[model samples]
Target: MQVKTFSGASSQEVLAQIKAELGADAVILSNRTYRKNGELCHEIMAGVERPAQQGGAGMPVSAGAAPAPSSGAGWSEWHKDWMRVKEQLFMLMKPAIRMERLTPRQRVALEYLQREGVSDGVSIALYNMLAARPGASVLESLAGIVPIRSWGAAAWPQRVHLFAGPYGNGKTTAALRCALRLRKEKPEMQIAFINTDCLRGNGRLTLRHWAELSDFGYLEAADAESMRKALALTAEADAVFIDTPGMTPERNLAQWQHEMGIDEQPHATHLVMCPFYDGVQMQALLHRYAADGDTSLVWTKLDEAVCYGALVNVAHEARLPISAISYGPELKQSLSPATEPMIWRLIFKRQLPIQSGE
Candidate 1:
């Protein structure tokens, strides 16, 4: 890995420099703000993995020799090692967690969270936050890790939106719910639905039915050329929602988008997921659906989940804000723009985000 330090007047400026020099794959090792020469400055240490034989385009010299492993494989191995090390470190630090400083209620809450399947890292962070401030509640400490950026025009100003996730995760439903919510809020806004899941009969029919009934424009795109024409047709609309197909284990969302020419547009991709998956499955799904640029998490099937600990774990791991959440079997009135109160209530009380008389 090649590491370098960048300093600038602002963190955004320093980050831009890092991305420009190290490419988008660069990871920030550390960042700090300090005063230099009577002026406030931001400094960050960023590192990027060195490419293997840059000019060779990852190809082996000899035709008979085996091809080198890809960078993704290398990173996967590194991530596994890092997770093992983190678990070991957390075990070592477990004894040092000063639980005595917390109130009885706070301690009970933390213990409950542990039983609910929250990760060790999040527990330690909550412990530190509560111990550092005597008056801080467990919910407040959790809010620091689980950020909420509600879904709407205000939160997501991008004209193009894409929904992606694993099979049976409710990607199509979430996209439709979001569009309906946006339409309810602004009746004059022009909305369009572009269905890319041509292989799925149910999803395609659902999207087409809702689009036509609601008087919203709809199009289907199964390839790069079709996707281009679909986008061009919806260019005049105020908001364009693209419903993507569920990804298989062998496929990657970022690479697929790049191949389909969807990456060329300014858009936000919401990763719609259910909270019932185990830790390993959730992590695998996150890795498979990972993409560049604007992205957020949209947790679905909240009504079916027993324990919501995976939500906190995913939020902590991905560091992406929660945009919306969907529950119940019905699409209408089942989704809600994620809020801190709603999430905390669901996590701590097992309460659904259902409105009165719903």
Candidate 2:
């Protein structure tokens, strides 16, 4: 007997074809239903009495592959196991289904983010969550995902405030601005400046100039011993602001930190950056600097940045809150407390807040 296979959308359709080809003497060797690329198909294998040569199974019994015979009682056991696997595959693929439901605007927004150097995983995750929310606009969906902490969320902790970041990231400027803001918020508060960035050509002189003008106490520490001496002066002030050299390597930065006696001192460390936000290295920067919620993110020199996606991407990846933002060179007007709307304006619109006149 030769074995032949038939397939159709339903069993009756396939059975009719089987009867016409093999007559009533045909025996159904196997039958099963399954989904192929999300479409359901039914297949049947039948045996007919005929003198057949070996390997004649290559003949097109029907469209697609000819079904082979089952080992024992047919495909009952095989089908059961297959169905279980199919269900599990369907479950795991549900997220892909959700991805297919993204709106055109959301897709456009995703593309925009990716083009602006946002990581693929972060972009996909944000869009998937947005797609799941019905009636949610892209701007509205994005407004919820980007993390920002208002500058004023927590009052200036009466502790040593330290700023750390790579060179030219505006660490000194940020530390000075933070101190000035704190002083402005509380007029009677006494603030002192400690500069650990002894290597930079003009960092100490620049900070000292400002310190002399403001008449706030100032100390320059070149090594661990100097750092200790500078920190001791913090005892006489309401709050001490610590600024480290941006030129130092990561290991040296850690060494300076260790020598500075932060473990023994009540201190708040802020990771400063000039919005160099993009890619795996950017994420690594966040990981290396912004260790936890306690370590605030300080973004400096927004006036020089044309794209803010890096900041949003870093914030999303690190799950770190932006504590402050510096907009320009002027100390009085440049620094502002970070806020959701401010970050949203920069992110979605790619536009900073309009100055009063322009």
Candidate 3:
């Protein structure tokens, strides 16, 4: 495994630098802000591959290095501490272990168990899994446990494209990519790009950019009145690609539902997701987006990821049909619809290659 250190003025800048050079597969080892000279600067250490083991297994164990025998009182105290931890885990898991909804942490622990081939003692296994994957939370880990359903047929051509997800998850770019692809296939499809992202940046740009290049009709809406107008305009058009605002729907599904005017009819709604995020975070993001009932998924940043576990997990959990995949910033050619075989290859058929630092 190769470990690399990068220094920059800020954490975000340093993260971008490392990702650009080492790609997104690099695991972050540690990040800290340090005083360099007189200025506060960021320092990040990342690595590829797992850490080396402490010693070879061939060496015999040394009994002389073992800890001295503990007194009776000390032994009792240690045993009590172990029992307390055990009880806490049980209490924490008691409600949801069988509850239909799985939290991200529990989901990750389950995935860890699957990966490690551990068959029993879920509580202990979960603890050990958390220990190995620090910063991984129950909510984030469980997002992968989304259920599956048979999306027997797609209702695409008849409907406009609806894009939604957490902030900065790339909803706009994905929508534009879809618009571009549609333009190639049906030049006179009467498509309109609707910008529901009233906030700064994000989906607004993707819609605005595509509208500029292709002369596609553009609409902006914030409240129910505007959205109603946009929907009416879309009624006459062949397709309406709606770019929604990026919001984290953790505690308030109302905000998303209200903002999107959830009552309005949409041809298709796709949850745009980035591959670079951690497993637990990804799950939490998915859960929040999947709140709109049967929304589909569109995975972005494929060229930037290594592990395909999250992709598999999201598909299984949300039971959302995968609409499309956007590889890069390219227009028409960069987009492709999601397929079952494509997913199978990512997990079972392909051996991810190691990328050397550029």
* Residues 11-75, model 2: lDDT tens digits: 66776777678654455677678998888887888766553542443233321111333222333
Comparison by lDDT, 1 against 2, better one: 1
Candidate 1 per-residue C-alpha lDDT over 82-195 given as tens digits, one digit per residue, 9 for 90 to 100: 454344345535866878889999999999999999988788878888998997878878888898899989989999999999878888888989999999989999999999
lDDT of 1: 0.81
Q: Which ten contiguous residues of candidate 1 have the minimum total lDDT?
A: 58-67
Reference-based TM-score of each model: 0.77, 0.66, 0.54
The better-scoring model by TM-score among 1 and 3 is 1
TM-score of 3: 0.54
How far is 203's C-alpha from truth in model 3 (Å)? 4.7
Backbone clashes under 3 angstroms, per model = 0, 0, 14
Cα RMSD to the true fold for all candidates: 11.2, 18.0, 20.2
**Number of the top-ranking candidate, with lDDT as the measure:** 1
Evaluated at residue 274, the lDDT of candidate 1 is 87
Ranking by TM-score: 1, 2, 3
**Model 3, CA-based lDDT:** 0.57
Against the true structure, candidate 2 reaches a TM-score of 0.66
Q: After superposing candidate 1 on the true structure, give the runs of residues whose Cα lies further than 4 Å from its correct spot.
A: 1-70, 74-82, 355-358
